[model samples]
Target: MNIVLFGATGNIGKVILQEALDRGHHVTAIVRDPAKLSVQNPNLKVATGDLLRPASYEASLAGADAAIASVNDPDPDNVPKQAQVLLDTLAKAGVKRFAWVGGAGSLEVAPGVRVIDDPNFPPAWKPSAMGMVKALDVFRASKADIDWTFISPAAHIEPGERTGKYRVGGDQLLVDAQGNSHISQADYAIGLLDRLEKGDAARKRITLAY
Candidate 1:
């Protein structure tokens, strides 16, 4: 696969970049500073661009088989706007395969309740979580001629060893025997790549856990 990735230097994005390259897929990463990528492979290509100015990275989508975004906007309120920009630009660029690195807050804890709805969802995280919730809404309601997937990680994700073992679920948060929900960032990248390679969960949100 020839993949074009945004935020390829981020905490999770960099892991995705390495996973894609390790799988022998060609990747063209659009970044403001390519120096931060730090990965060198014959299949890896770098392009200069910024998400703030969609036009700067619009041309990078040419010949891309899939586009993945792992973007972060500190303001939280701007998340949906960011998602919209990606969808609109990718649509115009004729890139149909799209995936967003989503948040776990939107995952349902019950039939009609979300993790963010919990009383202990953490005040600091709600703003960003809500931003992603609205971003997911944008993806769900989007009429773009694109196949989209929103991949959410476990409720608790951080740097950890990659065991390459995990479970996949939709809508609901996955928990283990200890009632814990978490997965290593490296394994999470593997899960995302698996979905892209297998074409799983199109037009829906799938989550990862261990």
Candidate 2:
């Protein structure tokens, strides 16, 4: 499969890029700074562009089998709009398969309540989390023919070893017996690329955690 990936330089994006390549798929990574990506493979192609300027990268999406977007913004204000632009561009390009990296905060911890709404939720993470929540809604409300998948990571995602194993869940938060939610960045990438390759969780919001 020929995959077009956005945000190839990000923490998660880097792992996703490697996962795609390791799966023997052709990957075209679209990023602002090509130098940030160190992967060198015949199947890997790096393109320079910004997500805000979709027209410049339209060609990158052409003939692509699927697109995995991992774009993020520190400013909560810009995240939703940035996600909208990418979705709209893909729609216009007639790309039918899409997968978005989502936030755990939007996942319901209880009926009519979300993690983001919790009083103890960190103020520093709210903006980015809320942005992902809004982006998930944007994709859900789209009228396009695209088959979108929103993959949300666990509440505690950090650099860790990829055990090449993890559990998958739906809207409810996935927590261990110790009452902690966590997933290795490597395993998260593995899960995301696994879904991308298998087309699992199409038009759905799925999550990965230990």
Q: Per-residue error at 86 for model 1, in Å?
A: 1.1
Q: Write candidate 1's Cα lDDT for 1-210 as tens digits.
A: 999999998999998999999999999999889888888899999999978688798777888888999988788888899898888888888886888999999998899999999998899998999999999999989988778889999999999998999999999999999999999999999999888888877888899999
Candidate 2, 110-169: lDDT as tens digits: 998999999999998888888888888887887767778899999989999989998999
Q: For model 2, where is the 10-residue window of minimal lDDT?
A: 74-83
> Which one is best on lDDT?
1
* Per-candidate total of colliding backbone pairs: 0, 0
Say what the RMSD of model 1 is: 1.2
- Whole-model Cα lDDT of every candidate shown, in order: 0.90, 0.88
Alpha carbon deviation, residue 1, candidate 2 (Å)? 0.9
